[model samples]
Target chain A: MKTLTPIEQLPLFTTQIKAFINWTRKNALWPLPFGTACCGIEYMAVVGSHYDISRLGAEVVRFSPRQADLLIVAGTITEKMAPVLRQIYEQMPEPKWVISMGVCASSGGFYRAYHTVQGIQSIVPVDAYVPGCPPTPEAVFQAVIKLQEKISKGDTPSQRLVAKKKMAELTSGNLENTGS
Target chain B: MEYHFQLVHQIKESLGDKAITSVETGIGNPFECVLVVRREDVRKIAEYLKGQRNFQYLMDICGVHYPNREQTLEAVYHFYNRDQKQRVRLKVPHKEGESVPSLTPVYKAANWFEREAFDMMGLKFEGHPDLTRILCHHQFVGHALRKDYPATQNQVCDAPEVFSFPPLPLNEDEDVLTNQRTLVNIGPSHPATHGTFRIYAELQGERIMRAKAEIGYLHRCFEKMAETHKYQQVIPYTDRLNYLSAPMNNAGYCRAVEKLIGIEIPARAQYIRVILNELSRIIDHLVCIGTTSVDMGALTTFWFCFRQRENVYELFEALCGNRMLTTITRVGGVYGDIDDEWKRRCTGVIKTLRETIDEVDRLLTNNKIWLNRMKGTGYVSQANAIDYGFTGPCLRAAGVDHDLRKAEPYYDYDRLEFDVPVFTDSDNFARYMVRMEEMRQSCRLVEQAIAKIPDGPIQVNDPKIVLPPKAEVYTNIEALMNHFMLVINGIQPPKGEIYSYTEAANGELGFYIVSDGTGYPYRVKVRPPCFPIYSSFEETITGGQIADAVATLGQFNVVAGELDR
Candidate 1:
């Protein structure tokens, strides 16, 4: 077989680029089912039928860190699972957004014990926090929509401000409580 | 019944000087006979019961450690007369170093119970076939359940001594010797083995020859944790046990506390409890049946069942505001009443569930491939099932008509109209059918509960047990103070011990709480259905094919949290 020139590809157009971007965004939102514990059960519920996350075109929950884009940290991330969680985050492709889907994932909720990681943001960057000891499936859907909003706005993924914000809240106790 | 009591008395007379005090009744019915027989008499007594007295079903075997007593380890055996419907308690006290003879040769259920006693309290069972540590790892040194055993700093250093099964002739190649028994550890990853669990399987080719379940990965010392936390504070921890069936765990805990407090729950509360309990049961059996299908390569059925479960979880979320771990029930009653919106949502979900269940049945029930994969794979003989003390759908699948919902009706289960589904096969297919039928019955129970739900205060009228409404807490100072006290320092029941059980999705989820007239429970012991069922996995799947083990394990529906706890 003779070698072919690399420049024989079709010319890129604005419509094609937009379509490609839209299609890639829709098709490849490989959700990292970063389920740490119990709330992970509800996280499954979100992707499951009642909420039907597939409607947003992001139902393929990847267990591996390398193949994922959206990380749904749906349970209590203890100290033990934290390092592994960070490793998984580091393995994910760039422009990854983390959805902390429960109170346990958000701020350690009921289990703010010494062993618990307090919040998942302590390890990975979080874009949204669905608050509850275990957030309801509806709340999980809303969080997913919120993440999609940020993506559609062309906004960069939020850094670890939530962790700092939580630390500050704990230290100062001056922040107004959000509608959890 | 009198003759049965006389027979038990005759047996006690046979023991003569060995038999200690036999307390009759206060604990209800069957006539409680406490035997202070020597540890060596355990097997003899077990044999005698089976041979002479006909105490066929070994209902439960519990190990109690009295650190201050003359004899430290007390193994209590509760046997039920299958034909007579009578229960008897047989107690044998042993010292720390002594080894009791195993009754596993007689009633195979004693196999796991004996191993558990050995693993937890370090009480040895002489002549127990393959009695290495069952729950804790091989390296686990100290028995955690012993009164003197330190809760913290317990470690298993070395691998347990391998149980020598009947050895097959060498396969010529030396490499076969090295690779014959492949050990695979699954879970503690949150999803693998239903709740936090680790299974160490000894596989002879993909087939699990003798797999030992290493539980307590997510122990959290919940028993000790409950001991420190107040009665109300412990509800949240119960939610973690069987995350799939939190309501059952909650009900078990609350029922135990209610018994100790000696207060009757309101009729409305009972109805609410029945509804929620049945709802949880529906969700649980859905997960069990669905996950078993998933384990056996039936993804579509799993999806269908999961769809139904999604609606169920939404109902739970609507009622409790939490999906996975709904710490909805309070000490005396529920945290709050289901509002009009919640009731409407529940009704809507229930309707959907009925249709979804039918959809799931259509997808799974008659599917030839599904049936082929499960049919004769993990068959438990009727004799073995009863011998193993298998409860829930596992025993029901083996043709046992015993269901705690009917046998020992709790939370107005008697009032609820539903049929217990049973099958004779006792295989994975039978278990699948049982759970599917159970979900349908649960739906019927929920419908009945919803229709007859009385208009009254949801919580019990007794102010000591349940907290006032949150709205009242915000307005009234007394209510606010009551809320503060209830939240911080939970309710304290009088000094007493009570055993309470509920028909959890998997089986009978029971809790025995001992209160020392303190805010916290004196001791909390969970009689989770999964622990015994999971422990019997090795025996169940021993001769079956490799896929059968996974299907069997899935069919068992062993929640690791409940198992380890």
Candidate 2:
């Protein structure tokens, strides 16, 4: 048997592992661009040369969902498109986060009518919401930073277990006053 | 004016009392000449007008619902004669279930327009091939543009089942070798399609055997909402249509209402409009060329173009408060005047854009790969182009000298000296060449506008249409009352209908507004150019390769915002 050092015995190794994992996750956020409308044009501006999204380490925008960790819903999602959005969310690997960009994705913006979904939150869980008709590239960058901050909190085996349990409870309709 | 009177006389003489019900010249307005015809005789009269009277171009076909009238639905048609530079409106009123003969046999462009009319107003066309819901989903319950439809009513629909492609028929010659063809779905959320446009292509190896384009995924019901919103309030909605060139839509709708109210804006406002509209054209062409190059595996040109686009966006931000969705124009005039600083910034941006375009042209014009990819792809005959009602650069690429700016001049376009570039070959490369030359012409127009802009008030002095200045409104009772009435009730044009067309970046962006002497518009129908251009996609890409289809779609530059609006 190997003997542990005093520092290792003090339970600092898990904390160090969590910090390293969180740092890597925060830095490399592969975004799946769910661009649909005018906000999609602004998203292109964010990915363009002047306000390059590569500065924040989110340059590789994957169109497919399986390889992505961040879903940027960048336009209005109509009623017919809701299931496709959910399917993309489910296809993304676990530990995924969503950033609802622009007012349409956040709360339907100026399109408050029959076909437009009220907000993307009705279809998928959103980690952050950027507000603008089609938000500027700077607003998109700020949203990326906010999402990084949220990601920096890190995840552990225990946290995953709690999340899975909570999801199960919610899906099973057993969410009876689990006090926050 | 003589031509307008002759058109009315000829139409009434040709179509006797059985076909022609009444003809009304717009009172106090010289532009509009409306002909009301019997519902059953619409197709015959349309053909007569096209064949005998040389009204070769069908500008728009839309429907208006009048709930309380004996005939509840009216289908309206706008036809333009290129030689005479004259336009006529045909209105056919019918009962709710009575069918109007389809115009698809006469003009193929009416395919999607008739579908839109059916989708919005529930007016059926008897002989139409595929008259299904176009701007709304198939599950939508009621016609949205009907006067009785509630603005707040929303229905929750079940998500559609996963699409299964129909099996392709086996060719008689190749049945033994290969029995199945592959079905490829390109978009609805693809980077290639630019927006929510879907193309389903049936491929035999590398060649696209058949392709069907499906739209309406981003249809936010703009026309329905326009009925409920006040006339001026619809400007923001127009911004979302063809969002890349929002100022053009803004200017088009405002000009239509201005014509209705018989208001000629100040010379300064018109010149400013010309400048902004030309700037929007440059921006739109930049995106079209940049994205086309990007799709063809060239990244450097995209970067250069987008950098220049950013500069143009900055100029727009300095002029208005927004970058992409700028609702800059108002009912009577523009939202603000261009100051010296804005002029300086615009000039700088135009210089940068010229330099960037020169660089892009040097890089891509003679590149062996670009020429090989673009030269012979997506060829359209002149007949097919006109049949599909192609306008703007698309029609120009097919060797048609049908630029509305030249044929039907509006807003001092006749005074401006700019060449309309045309090409004999109707391919992707020709379209690119036309757009490139158009960007140069737009730059020239902007320069001329800046040089020739007359100094005056940006807004008209009419308190009935334009709000008074803020300082005057704060101090003077008359100004305050005008401001209060304008804001509270909105601008009211006379009870009449006007069809106004502007040469937008895509094509002829027409706005047909029917005002009922009220704050809210009775019916507003937008003739978005992309609708017809997009309708021709399946025909364009049927025999091309899948890679060429993407390149051709980029050349077409169909903005889904306008196409599905």
Candidate 3:
């Protein structure tokens, strides 16, 4: 019995390693606030004295994307701001998750205008969504908890998209390479 | 008000047909007197008014679109005089392709306004130095504010903005290394920026040589979206303008619609409006001071102030279920009336707010570090302040002593007893002091309003303007039909335009509404107070240190929603 390499379509050892990695990530997710508009004020309340976000172990709020693992997009993503958001997302050292907070970021909210992006999902892969014009502080907390759950399960949307992309490349007329 | 007619006559005497064509002064119009100027004479008239007649403040320059008129677009200019307490409107009616003269040479504040007018309505100015799209993506094709542009046709642009600043000249004493100035871009998402505004600065050894701003990252098309919806439906959009004090925007918008429809809400509603607006002012000031301190690395002040801010937000949540975006005003009056518990909570929160403000005062008032960061940094003169269209506390801080509440009283502010805080230092610290004192004055006004509010109906009793009660609508046929028509067709104001302004948390929040006698408004232009405040930001921070820009920007309280809307 030869040793099974990772991504052999049935690597039990790889699954165990992935679970271990996800567990570590789930506990210490440093969040960066991509706050642009009104939802930013609500996010301030989240990190403020009343509803302190430190209890969830995600209290390390880094403004720079390089130091963050969870990007909490807290406002509207206009057309002029989309490329900046994309650059920020790409700059975060991989194994990152994005939580699209507020209806403005998730679906552009009531601002179906010429400047607003329809949803942030069109630009970055959002792992969770908090629904409100400016979501309450508790909704943001719920999103954090939900993101942790997704992290521990190793079923994040970004990972799923990567897997789908890998499978699409693998199935492109190279059946013997994987099926054999 | 007679001075307006006299001023028009004065202009007519001076320049006759070369300057102005006609004057609009009637008993029916509720706002300022209008002077219909010749299209080619905008710059000349503006210069004449500012240089000769003391119309120093260029308050707004906006484009109003009318499809059926022979001249499809009109560039409306609002000018104000601080010493005289006079505000006048100038109209330059022109076709789509016709070019009008730029008012930039007269008022330094006209640069951004003319750019905005161009970006929105495609109104070209002849002598504008660098007229470009100010509020839209560079790749945007059509002017979104025009009547023909589709409101929902959103274009997705993924290109990053490149910064280009006009270089400043090097001094004769500067060395070669100092002459090689480094250009640094601040942020659309930097921590010190506190909002989505990018500042391109040329720095020489941490001193800014030249600075410029490129905003519109939060331009959600507030005006374009307002035109697509009904009159009452636009209240929520206005609430997002300055989310810190949303009810103030609602009050401005609803009062504008009420004035257009000519419906007077009951005295109780008026009192409630005043109380709500004052509380919002207190909250806005607290947050502005708190956030500015946080941006400057003074963390304790943020905790002290935001704790009190949360108290006020809880008070707002008790009345309206939403915390931040409180769409709490209807067309005729408020969405809901206040109760004894809400009033008690208001007093309780104001008490806590005073304690917090005092605590913050004690912590930062004499701190040597805070003084070094704020005092004497970002100094602006009174002339530069008024020339750049500064208003509210910022203008008052510059020693102009102009408050819309005291100068042009609205919402029965003339009856209220309070002091307008004015500071002459005109620095970052002076602006902070003005805001702190303004909050205390607001508290005083709220206390008086609570004791003096009359007991009456909250909304107007007109079926055409205000909706009937739900119980009456369910029982009576006429009430049901009225409710159905009101909800279905919306309030149909006459085919006219009204410019209504109020003393908002930041400055004069004006609503310029043009109705086409239909459910949907033809065009809605919000004169956001933060617009001109930010247009002067480049000059305010030019000679200061990089950190001083952060301190001044935070104190300016330039809400991105209002600045780019």
Candidate 4:
């Protein structure tokens, strides 16, 4: 790690400062809800008139998956739904975050049996896990707050590097596992 | 008494001198008597019940597998009379792949019910016009509900051939009139489906000639999963099925298990159950009415209804600590008791909701545009509605006087006073009005239950069945041990089967639990109301306009979670 000398870094970091400002302004995300089950309902309630998550910049609830920057995996991922869920997560643009919003999404909750995907993390790498059978809108709001914190870290090195590396990794992993 | 005696004697006289195979009086009123009839006489006897005896409504067609019995499979038909208001059960046996004569010719409702029977249990219907899978995919093999079928994923299926429509013969990419109806898959991805559902519609110039619902995209095999989980553990799964009306499914499953074990809950617990159930009904109806209006192009009505629904969710969150798929009620009773603050807030919310409902009614009920969009659209004649075995608001909309609350009156419903609103026309408009009226009735029911709640214990006093209090379990060794065992292994019920039906927001949500003296249910069958209602979609929308399909199905409030379960 290199130390920052005030005078030496000031002129050099000026361009970086301008870029950070632009990134922060653009990345003030407005989530599009694609909620399906119990968690999806709570996700709506969180953004609805009561627990207004719009206060934290997610005012626009777009129904389509393409526009969302944060994909909240908020319900049970059954075998029939797994493919669609993966497709939706893949459709979302890069620099996205996933909030596993319930026990089901975190680790299949009460349905950690044969049909359910063991955890949503297996499909999309989750940034935060909201641990409850169906976490309250307040807890969901808190998870969003945590996502904002992760966002404020500026350049997510792990996310950028891993996202690039994982395509090949996933293809090979799928070959070994599901043999797709 | 007269109807029951007449029906019993009629069964004995009509079916020769065959001994009654089973007589069960414990399953509520109109005590069920099952008589095994030869497969050849099923349609003849069903026709007699329809033409002469006036058992007009084929309530349901279900198949029960008896592996050890002399006969292999028993296809049971539950019939109910419109005038006499009595039920009769008919049981007929079938060998593998053999046909039982279809009752569709007698009762049109049996068309889809028999299709479902064929899908899950592989009981063939010989005389049916179209015998296809209703819940599972078209290509899915293996009878899921068979006793011999393995419950887990390990029972591997030889993947069926995936057939795609032959690519349109290209003429240099020029569009041509092929004289073939264009097939459009309207969902399984579309927003209006509510869940993973696809409607394979054969469109002949925007008129759907054949609109087949291809479900099972969210098929979790809930019944098979129930067998592995303990009886108490299965309640959460019920919450997932009809997630919009979670409490109803939770209570329905719990009631079945309680009936099998003969566990009587305390009055306060029953009152709480009633309150939660009514609240769920109001919320579920709000979604239905809101979506119906939204489909009819009244987007503002959905906003109003959804705003009020938010408050309901808040009240639910306050009481149960979770909102959707609440898992509020446990096996023997509710998970915990509601305090005075939650009760007071709920009372105030219900009062405010009544005012909001009046505003909403003013906006959508009499509005000419809303009326035009709904008024004669998707009309199901009185006969067709009953013949399709529609229930809840959809049936009530068609002037049917059947409400499980009035007919069976479970959970002290008889003690409450409420009117079952019935509309004469079974159109989309009438269904919307019926649900709106029913929401008001649910509000009334909730207020009554809240005011009359007693000062007794909430849970039933059975340590073997109901786990001890959480605080007690944390402190006391004996309580902790009971909790550990109960949570780990599940509560065991006596070796018996019980069917308990609840008037869910959609329709009759019944749970049939077969317990073999074990902690987990041997086989838990769910009678999801949406399956039958959605099955009637193609029949209802045959000659109607394209937009009527959405309005009609929206009024049905067919949640795919429950429909495909």
Every model's TM-score: 0.80, 0.93, 0.94, 0.85
DockQ of 2: 0.57
Q: What class would a CAPRI assessor give candidate 3's docking?
A: medium
For all the candidates, what are their Cα RMSDs to the real structure?
A: 8.4, 3.9, 5.3, 6.2
Q: Per-residue CA lDDT of candidate 3, range B194-282, in tens? A: 78999999998788988879989999999999899999889999999998899999999998888888777788889888988998998
**Residues A111-159, candidate 3, lDDT per residue (tens digit)?**
9888999999999988899998898999899999988998888787666
Task: Report the Cα lDDT for residue B189, model 4.
Answer: 50
**Which residue pairs show collisions in model 1?**
B138-B160, B139-B156, B139-B157, B140-B156
Among the candidates, what TM-score does chain A have in each? 0.73, 0.80, 0.79, 0.74
In model 4, which residue pairs have backbone atoms overlapping below 3 Å? B109-B387, B188-B197
**lDDT, model 3, position A177:** 54
Interface RMSD of each: 6.2, 1.4, 0.8, 4.0
Q: How many clashes does each candidate structure show, in the order listed? A: 4, 0, 0, 2
Q: Candidate 1 — which residues are off by over 4 angstroms?
A: A1-37, A54-58, A63-132, A137-180, B1-8, B22-37, B65-73, B91-99, B122-124, B129-212, B339-345, B469-489
Question: What C-alpha lDDT do the candidate models reach, one value each?
Answer: 0.72, 0.86, 0.87, 0.75
**Candidate 2 segments exceeding 4 Å error:** A1-15, A155-180, B1-15, B26-32, B161-173
Model 1 Cα RMSD, Å? 8.4
Report the CA-based lDDT of candidate 4 relative to the real structure: 0.75
At residue A73, candidate 2 shows an lDDT of 96
By lDDT, the candidates rank as 3, 2, 4, 1
Q: Write the per-residue lDDT of candidate 2 for residues B477-517, one digit (tens) a residue.
A: 99999999998999988898888888999999988889999
What's the distance in Å from true for residue A99, model 2?
1.2
Candidate 3 total steric clashes:
0
